[model samples]
Target: MLGGIIEFLLLKQSLPIGLSLLISATVVSLIAVLIHRLFIAKTKNATELSLIIMTIGISITIRGIVGILVDKNAHPVKPFLSFSSVSLFNLVFSSQYVIVIFSTLVLAFLLYFYLKKTLSGKIMQAVSMNSLAARLFGIDVGLVQMSSFAISGFIGALAGAVIAPISFVQYDMGIMFGLKGFAACVVGGFGNNNGALIGGLIIGVAESLSAGYISSSYKDLIAFLIMILVLFVKPSGLFASKDVERI
Candidate 1:
C-alpha cells in the first residue's frame, strides 16, 4: 500500500521508474529499521503473541494514516515498458509480468547469495537460528533483527511497486497481499526460502488455473483451499526439513 502510493507519487512528479523504485525501497527500508528501533526494540520482555499483536496494531495505524494522507480510491500506475506487451511461445503477456518475473528471480538469487556467502548474513542466520547462542558468540542480535526488517521492507516495497502496474495503487491493498504471503509461507515451510518460493509458484499457478477454468471470483478461495489442504496433509509443509522447528 505505502510502496504503491509512494511510487505513484514519484511517477506523478515525472521521476524515472528505476529511480523512483530505488528511492521508495530505500525510504521503506529505513522506515522498517526505525519501526524496530522505536517500537519493537523498546518492548520489555515481549512475548511472541504480544509482539504479533503489536505488529497488527502498527499495521492498522499505518493503514489509517495512509487512508487519511492518500485518498482511498484506487489509482492506475503506468506500465514500466513503453510497449504494452510481448509475445513468446505463441502466447502474449503483459510486459510488466516479464519485469516482475525477472525481478523476483534476481532478488531471490541475490538474497540466496547474501545469506550463504556474506558475514553479516551469516550472523543474521545465526541469530535467527538461536539468538541467545549468537549473542554468546558476540553477535548483535538486535542489529541482525533490524537488518532483517529492512530487507523485508525493501523487498516488499519493490514488490508493491512492480505489481502496481497490474494491480493498481490503493491505500488498503496490502491486506489481501499480506494474507496471500502468509498463506505462501504456510504452504511452504516457515524458515525455508526454497519452500516458500515453490509454494508461491504453486499458489500462483492454482489461482491462474482457477481464474481460467473456474470463475475468476474463486481465485482467492482456491488459494486458501489449497493452503487448508496442505495444512491438513502436512502441517510442516511439503518441503519442511525435519530439523526445522515451527513457530
Candidate 2:
C-alpha cells in the first residue's frame, strides 16, 4: 500500500524520492500502530487467529484503496542504485544484486547480535518464550508485543523501499511476496529467525531452479509443493526440534 503511494508521489506528483518514502513510511507506521491499539489489543479470544483475520481484511482494504487512488496499473520506479555488471570466473552479476546481498548479510548480522546480546532483545525473546512468565517478572508483555510490531513494520518498510526500484510498484504486488514469505517461515521453523533466513534462501534457490528447468509458470507451484512435502514429511519443520511437554 505504501509502496504504491510512494511510487505515485514520486512519479506522478514529482515528489522527491527520499521525501516520498519518508512520508509513506510515517503515515503507514502511524496507521499500523493505531490499528494495533484499537483492534488487535482489544481482542479477547484467540489473538493470533484474530490477528490473521484482521490482517487479511486490512490487506484487502489496502488493495482496494490503492487501486482507487492509483488505478490498477503498474508504475515503474527509477533505480536507486545503478552500476556496471561484473564478471567473476564464468559468472556475471549486476551491482544491484551485489548490494542486495551485502545489505541482507549486514542486516542479518545486526539482528543476530541484537537478539543475542542486547537487553531489550533478550526481553523480547523472553516475552516470546512465555509472555505470562515475563509479565509475572514485571515485564510489560503488551509493550514488548507493540515494540516487536513496530520493528517489524520498520523492516518491512525498508524492504519495500529497497525492492521497489527493482520491481514495478503496483497495488497487489505484495500478495505473492507475502505468500512466499509465509511459505519460507513454514519451511524453516516458524518463530525461528535463523530458520527463516535459511528457508528463504532455500526457496530462492528452488524457485530459480524450477524456473530454469521446469517452467516459469511452475515456479510458484514448486515452492508450495516443497512446503507441502515438508509439512507432510515433518510438520515440525526441517529445522525445528520436536518438544514434549510434561503433564
Best candidate, lDDT: 1
lDDT of each: 0.90, 0.74
Q: After superposition, how far is residue 229 of candidate 1 from its true place, in Å?
A: 2.2
lDDT of 2 by residue, 1-247 (tens): 4644564566557777667766666666666677678768887875767789988998898789888977788777665554546677879977556655766678778878888899999999899888999999999888888777766665565556656766678888888878887778778876667787898899989999999999998898977898888777766667873332323
Per TM-score, the best of the predicted structures is 1
In order of appearance, the predictions have TM-scores of 0.96, 0.87
- Where model 2 places Cα greater than 4 Å from the true spot, the runs are 4-27, 241-247
Count of clashing residue pairs in every prediction? 0, 0
What is the Cα-based lDDT of residue 201 in candidate 2? 92
